[model samples]
Target: MRCPLARMTAETPLRYRFVGARGVRAWIAAPSVAQTQTPPRPLDPTEVETIAIIGRPSSQIAETLRRKRAAEVISDGVSAEQIGDLPAANLAEALQRVPGVAIEREVGEGQFVSVRGLGPLFQSVTLNGAPVAFNENIRNSTQSGRQFRFRALSVDLLAGARLAKSSTADMIDGGIGSNIDIETAGGLDGGPFLALRAGGEIEERTESLRPDLSIAGRIVSPDGSKGLVAGISQEDRRVRYDRFQIMRYGAFAVSGAPLTAPNDVRTTVEREDRRRRSAFLGADWRVSPNLKLDFDGLVSSFDNTIREDRLCPPSAPLRQIEGSV
Candidate 1:
């Protein structure tokens, strides 16, 4: 049975109630019930369709999960994830769990990355699918500009990171072992949100303390047609390394084995004071459904001073020269 003017009441027989074409509420009852209420105008077919669609789903990891899953399905290898979802503070530390990856650090900072057991020389890195070229002529007898310096990159502005193992024609050249692409976040990618993080660390061996901070935010237009995002991160750190070296393999030869006691080892100590910071800005405009525009830029700076003291018997008698010998 139907009711002409059903109302929200203490005892409504219908499981659900809805307003009909008229002003009267529609409901189901055992027997017909009619209430005198003014008739309403009819709803247009377009209005009914518009009211049927609901809002979109929301989740922090939704977009990243989709991309990673899509890549897994479309490509032969690799995965991707948002940087904020990573457990480590730096890209190097985060990549250690990415399987077939290794990290090398200098003075307690990740200096380089190795993939598939190959050294950094075979590994290539890029920012937003473009190789970050380095000067090979400036190599100080040690570096040949084979890989990007991980220590110089800041994780604060990272939107997402991916490890591409399978080679593709569109991928930037240079990766023999593996290719890593790091994308920065901003504008529509970040959406309308604010993120703040602060932490500190103390190294007992170094007998020093350090502080870390990061701030990021994204603002979008009322209709979400335009947006801007910006962020900054800074950290101060001190590290110390002290150890003893055997000096030479001949020191362990036969009779020299007994002469190669720990006391005969050379002693060295080094201390480094480091400061790091990263800043980024981004803009996005959805001019139309099929056309859009995006602009992003980032800069990172690292400054450090190192002091070393060494007591190696033979080398102690001579002064060491700096720069290429």
Candidate 2:
């Protein structure tokens, strides 16, 4: 009919531990006696404490999630939580805390992270263990190497994100920098989770405002066997730079003697505005207790326009005039 209830202790998280039968059972407190099955006691202080402690139970589910993550990690890694709760303009800056992690910044904002001093081309970025496309939000699309642009990403919806300093056969290939795998929100990660983030920054010189916004969440079935998560992020930024250089052209000889002069000089000012949008989707199903299936997708688009003002002064090399003489 009943058995001694499991004791509540911090050493072992709170969970039902049936000693007797598993089909259907209940908890019954046993009182101390010389040798008796029943004692004359409604409830005692000790028994009362036990019942009260059960009311506030530690979540075994949370512990399960922690252990699962630990099992999935095989090498030295950096998780999003390791990034700490601090002010970061982009994911690249958030990753700076990881050992051997370096980031490249564009217009004072982090754009890419290099692992172990290796450049982005050496690193591979993945979403939920799947490769995300290579769409960098930068002025130069011609930039080389395989890399993900951190500037276009928002970190609000990740269940877990990690950069693996090493790799195994199970991991996807092509990351000389590091293999950075990001896990999206899943049914087990949370219940009815919703997150919204928005922020703005002002440029000192141009006095222009840059804005970013994102929303993400996950919804799960009642049994926690299936779930779906999706998110979208948008950002607008403006950048400026100035440069001056002397243009060199072929020069003529001066009176048959060798001579050369700068042919032209120019000063240029440039300004660029970029709008980037990124989105992600995730779905998972626990097919039968052991077999599980998951899907994740990521897409990004960037539109950048640049304006330039240039002034060039024309000059002729004196070598030509000397050769004529």
Candidate 3:
């Protein structure tokens, strides 16, 4: 049997349908009996519009590595996004993530930091390259050393932090071990954005929750040459600490032989209510293709209300052991 070839005529009908897109409904289009027989024409170049898309993708790790590679000295850093994603509450806690850096805790919160096993006094910390003063309200005011307390500042207001392991001519003195600098974003650097964050901190001893809140925003000029950024944060924390102290180890004669024993023993319990507030403001101006100026300012306040109870030996009666046994 032979099959006959089919021919299309104006009388034939044609139906076409297209898949639906997001926010668009699918529909069927049927050609008119007269239009189906018309010849196809090429599209006109002048009538068509050309569209182009440009994008630059960035992340905290990439930005950090870029800065590290570009810096003149041996340095490590963390970007703002990385800081925010970390499970850290304060600047000291965040700095612990850096290699060869360690932190000292007080009342379960990081307060002092050391670099490469060097003490806190050997390291220097700056806010936007400006020196930060020691906290006046720190415990044992008379014994306050050169170590700067990290408890006074909050992590939310920073754009990034850098730790320099080597010395540089432009850096300020006093950082024989290392230098740390925390920076805030300027208007043009952050672009135009507004963010509000809220969270809670739980203290295991009291079984109570504390509140934390922060607001950050940035505005850029229409010309894109100037901008300003600001951030404010407030946090409340409850801490309970128990401390045992052995004042000194002394040699005691027991039946003829000398034995080492603790001279005095003491115990203390501390309950603290801490409230911290920090604010940051920064502006950026691009004067020329190679010249850019930045201004950054930061202020923070830390309030600690403590209730402590101590048990100690009596000074006059229990202290005197006149002759060696």
Candidate 4:
């Protein structure tokens, strides 16, 4: 008797299938079909070159000009040192090129930036076009003897900054020294553009490495009705500073029979490490060709720590720690 063929079902076990059998052989023997190939299209070298040469469109150029103008206005008349580069570690370093701006260094690094003849506390700093006033607990006062430090604000977040020496009704009421305005850009253009910058420096005296990075981009719709822009940056830096402090004694030396030494000598050394990070986001709605509505948001954070030590010879006992750390 002939062997019976097994019936196939959707759920049949794999090991039970019939192989090399009469029914399977007929179903598996089918002829192969041929596929036709299409000819390749030729590349137009001229068109490719033209597209490359055209590069960014005219609208993009205009947007670039606008940004340049804004930066120039903010830096106008400022010294090269003061405005050396936008993303400096602190206002003092940023303003070093400006005339009348003085920076006190500790251990060959900038400790504080002084404007005109005013102290650090006398200066006011603004962020994102808004004033960053001191809290009630940290109010500004001469007697308080506390001052603002440039390291407190993030340099990365600022696309541009302006130092205003003269007073204006629109500015903060206080600050005989100067006012610092920090601005952020909103990435709201409907075009595709990208910008990236990074650098690192090694200081010989401090033996420290400084590194910085920044990225900015914009996306705009073809119709130009809407756009988005954004920027982000971070920096890590170390600075050294050295300076002298003067101490006076014996105010009534002329009248008194015996007077203490009229003056004392002292030296100070300081080391500072700072880290900063910042981000900005902005959107634009084109209400009209010449007029548009823009909204921007910015966030920035900075951390700075200083280490100071004083040394004097054993014979010169006059040197002593005077202030609380």
Candidate 5:
């Protein structure tokens, strides 16, 4: 039980070396064979060359055609008008020129907007793309009636407002009145723009110096992919109202006494003083070409006080009767 080993010699044929396990135990080198192919060489500078061919140039002709088409498109959908320069305080006044629009003034200032006879209460007001309808707690009291007031809304935050006469499913409903879309400076399609305004007026009767101030700005990225807009506005106004009236009353004496005067006379006087202040801020973020995010906030304060005085004749015949009765 002995294992065998293979050995090779120069005279042994390579193919017949595996006759037995002992014949395979040796190393052998194969003869070299000639190659039929050669390696590729790099191309020389003189062998490489550039070819330039010229064709008819039409860049100028194409540009002129594009400009003419653009002008036609712009003319079809937009129109231009020369509106005289107006102060910020009178912005609403300027907007009155638009068709089917109306404005209401409170204390000689534009405080309410109406579209096509629709009242302000029913219409929705928005700053940029956000609604400005925040819950406002207003308290009203009457001597004879229950104390109640409506939610007070203000348009001081708007740089401009547009009226949407037609209705769309996407827009808010319940308004038979036209929609008043307020435009704040911070939300504009154009690049960044800034504006600031401040002014005051004097009351002839009260001699009060009422003042107003506002600051607004907008910024857009150079690539038009991102933008930021912000605005803050404040207004202070004072109003005074007065009324005077005289009344005469007639009554019969209960007891048979010499009736010198059977009628009573009185004079009444009433005065009201009001002060209002409002402020607002808004922002917009264009997250993508089809999606946008917006936020807005506003605060307003109104204080009003009324004073009344009455004067009646003392010891009049009617007064004496009333006292006796």
Candidate 6:
């Protein structure tokens, strides 16, 4: 049976009823209902096709997740694409994005890394599962630990970096905080790849523009059994620093209490010229599915030259300077 409301039409007339003294006080009008129509049926499914999407950024993200999941210990990885996306000057700066990772800066660039609130001495750095020699600036010998300086290496020479926070049986023993493994791409990792970069940066204080150039490429054999990767980069930069120095502090009696004042005030201006060059070569050989040999070698050089000028202003003698105490 159809509903009563559904039988109502739009053309229904109005009706009025009069009570004893009210006289046609209330007037009722027929209610109008909107018609409802059935919705269209969905189309039938035809055929199913598979689509594979591959991109540099997306592939790198997928690979990072895969590496993180496959590791037996607690590990985090940063891909080259991710590192390149950031405005970092060195590998140490790029690594600051990872959890529990911190960097030490020198000369306005990241030089060392500390992991999990521990100093660099407690952390170990390796390249392709092998220990790399520690490289430091000759001018500074204060860093006498077995720490690896990240500033010595360029980010363009790396494919990815992984930090393992937990210990495992197959790892080296020196890392009490964490172990960092730097990975390089194999020649066949991507069919064929080449990158070239040339740019210039201007210093704020000096207003001088410096040039930076880098080139990297990979070549692989037909059978994909052998591959070679090589990259080189050079950067020339000039940095200036202005600082105020207080050689000593002295106490003087003012009114009734002793007051502290700076003694031997001096101003210094320092200009530094830095030149860095880095190169890396990698080889991947798949002798068999179970046995493979990978070789990665890196060479880097850094030159630093600094010139400084100082100006000192004479102050009152310490013996009677504002009633010394």
**Best candidate, TM-score-wise?**
6
How do the residues 1-325 of candidate 1 rate in per-residue lDDT, one tens digit apiece? 6553334443666644455664444456564445435467897766344456677654535764566677732221222244445556577766776667889876566767888888777877787777776535323346456766666667776865677776677787777777788777758864588889898888888877699999989999999889999999998888888888876532223322222323245888988888888999999999999988999888888788889898877522223333331
Model 4: per-residue Cα lDDT over 94-124, one tens digit each = 6666667787664344556678788677777
Candidate lDDT values, in order? 0.70, 0.69, 0.82, 0.61, 0.50, 0.82
Give the Cα-based TM-score of candidate 6 against the true structure. Answer: 0.75
Candidate 2 versus the native: TM-score?
Answer: 0.62
What digit string (tens of lDDT, one per residue) describes model 2 on residues 134-185? 7554345665446788766655545546677767677788876678876665
- Per-residue lDDT of 95 in model 2: 75
The local distance difference test score of model 2 is 0.69
For candidate 6, write residues 1-325 as lDDT tens digits: 9533335522455454556774554345645554235456899989979899986647888989987988888999798999998777888999999999999898889988889999888888888888887645333566557878788777888888989998787777888999998888776577668899999989999999999999999888889898999999999899999999999787765655667898689899999998889998888888998887888788888888999999988874544334434
Pick the lDDT winner: 6
TM-score of each: 0.66, 0.62, 0.68, 0.50, 0.50, 0.75
Q: Could you give the candidate ranking by lDDT, starting with the highest? A: 6, 3, 1, 2, 4, 5
Stretches > 4 Å off in candidate 4: 1-87, 106-111, 133-147, 152-157, 188-192, 201-211, 238-273, 289-291, 305-325
TM-score, candidate 3, is 0.68
CA RMSD of all predictions: 18.6, 21.3, 16.1, 22.6, 31.4, 8.4
lDDT of 4: 0.61
Worst 10 residues of 2 by lDDT: 2-11
For model 4 the TM-score comes to: 0.50
Comparing 1 with 3 on lDDT, the higher-scoring candidate is: 3
- Which stretches of model 6 miss by more than 4 angstroms? 1-57, 135-143, 250-261, 287-291, 313-315, 318-325
Q: Which stretches of candidate 5 lie over 4 Å from their true place?
A: 1-98, 103-114, 117-157, 221-224, 247-280, 284-325
lDDT (Cα, 0-100) at 253 in candidate 3? 64
Q: lDDT at 97 for candidate 2? A: 68
